[model samples]
Target chain A: MWKAEIKVLLKKSVLDPQGQAVEKALSSLGYGNVQDVRIGKYLEVSFAAGSHKEAEDQVREMSERLLTNPVIEDYTFELVEV
Target chain B: MKFGVVVFPGSNCDLDAYHLVKDVLGEPVDYIWHQEENVSGFDCLILPGGFSYGDYLRCGAIARFSPVMKSVVAFARSGGLVIGICNGFQVLQEAGLLPGALYRNLSLQFRCYFTYLKVENRQTPFTSGLEVGRLLKIPIAHGEGNYYADADTLRRMEANGQIVFRYATADGEVTDTANPNGSLTNIAGVCNEMKNVLGMMPHPERAGEAALGSQDGRLIFESILKNWEGAR
Candidate 1:
């Protein structure tokens, strides 16, 4: 079995109000040195694959088609055998 | 002309759309279930506002994959009239029927109130009854109503007159203070290149009757009816 770990985030050009709000909260909490904060989603999916290449391909496809919205978001993933 | 209001599992405004068309406008209307694929026989389809799929994993992300959306897409491609309101707008964007995406409000709050909209494009079938620069009082309710499109896409949409509505002052001044959701350029609504498919954050159905504190929204239904009649 292989587990695909994915992180989805709004594109650099897109505004992340949630992230900005969190950043403000952190600043108020005395984390003034933190210059930036970006909020994103993290997911872990475990599935059976014949080979690492097949798992990687499936993960990439899934991320593109369903896991992330390309219009406003970008995603990165890593696959690990479990 | 017949109207079909699609009913997704979490659609709370389906009845509002149906009531506006059937009761107020005195037109034939029906409810189309999300699992159903057939969308023929309806002159127009309305995707009403609500928390579809409990707004999980993005507002309209999961709902865009509903079986009925496939037929909706085909219908739209054939030049059928389709309107998506609020959550429906998000679904349309997710399904790639419309351009751009809605993000969380700049204030990060669920804004629910009456707002003024300046009609930017009167050529769309949905806004033909109104004159250019008309000011409409409509209610918007959503946390993610902020519209955003890349600079290039925004330029093209402007050139194509696809921008249908914009948040504005009651006097018809487009201003940032009037923007309820902090949408780019204060955009309140937009349509596809063909102008057959429209997606808007405001709830016209909720403002269709005088009892609702505004009858300005009735003009939208009237425009649709008038356009349909003229075409037939």
Candidate 2:
């Protein structure tokens, strides 16, 4: 068994409308100190595999195929021995 | 036809979709909770509209991580038919099963009303009952329906003919009034490269009855049935 930590984030250039709306609301509430805000998702996935390399490969494929949208999001993963 | 509708905690439209599928379409359907890990017996799976997980983090953020989504993703990858409507569309985007994200309405308000959609690609099983360029009257209720995608992705989608629907007027005129949300290229719906997975923001189940003023939404379900019948 191996543990994988996956971080999924929208591409830097993509407009995050939800974050923008919150920013606007904060400004309206008189909090002008907020500079930049971007929202993202995180997942900790666990699976049983023989080796770290195979586990990492599976995590990468999962991220690309279903965990993250390549067109708008970028993801990175780290595998830990269990 | 046997169908399954995934039901998350905050899913308000699951029953509505259940009735539409079982009562309106005269098909057998079941509601599967979001925590389930299997979805093997159904021919079709639907993620209906509503504020899943109370729209807690983002529109569909929390719901995307539901255990049921794993099965839904597997089903879609295997060429099974899946439809995500309204909030369901947002879930699909967050789950990375579909391209693009549904952003806040360009006007920055929650919009709830009837809108028109132009069928762009009828080759898909979802739209095969409609002619290309035909208009559909459907209701849309969402705050994040403004679709956004990069230029390259949009070009690829267009080139591959994956765009299934565009906002249009009732008379089939492509106009801005019908575009409730300022979606990129006025895209209302799209399919995966294989055209088996569909994500759209309109509530087709809400328009299946004539008492709702138009029964046009039935055609979408009918198209799915037609495709399944032909495949069998």
Candidate number with greatest DockQ: 1
Report model 1's TM-score to 2 decimal places: 0.99
| Residue-level error in angstroms, candidate 2, position B142 | 0.4
Stretches of candidate 1 above 4 Å error? none
lDDT of 1 by residue, A1-82 (tens): 9999999999999999999999999999999998878899999999999999999999999898788989899999999999
Candidate 2 stretches with Cα past 4 Å from truth are: A1-82
TM-score of model 1, chain A?
A: 0.96
The CA lDDT at B22 in model 2 is 92
lDDT of 1 by residue, B1-232 (tens): 8999999999999999999999999999999999999998999999999999999988899999999999999999999999999999999999999999998999999999999999999999999999989999999999999899999999999999999999999999999899998899999999999999999999999999889999888899899999999999
lDDT of 2 at B84: 96
iRMS, candidate 2, in Å: value is 4.0
User: Each prediction's DockQ?
Assistant: 0.81, 0.20
Q: State TM-scores per candidate.
A: 0.99, 0.79
lDDT of 1 at B22: 97
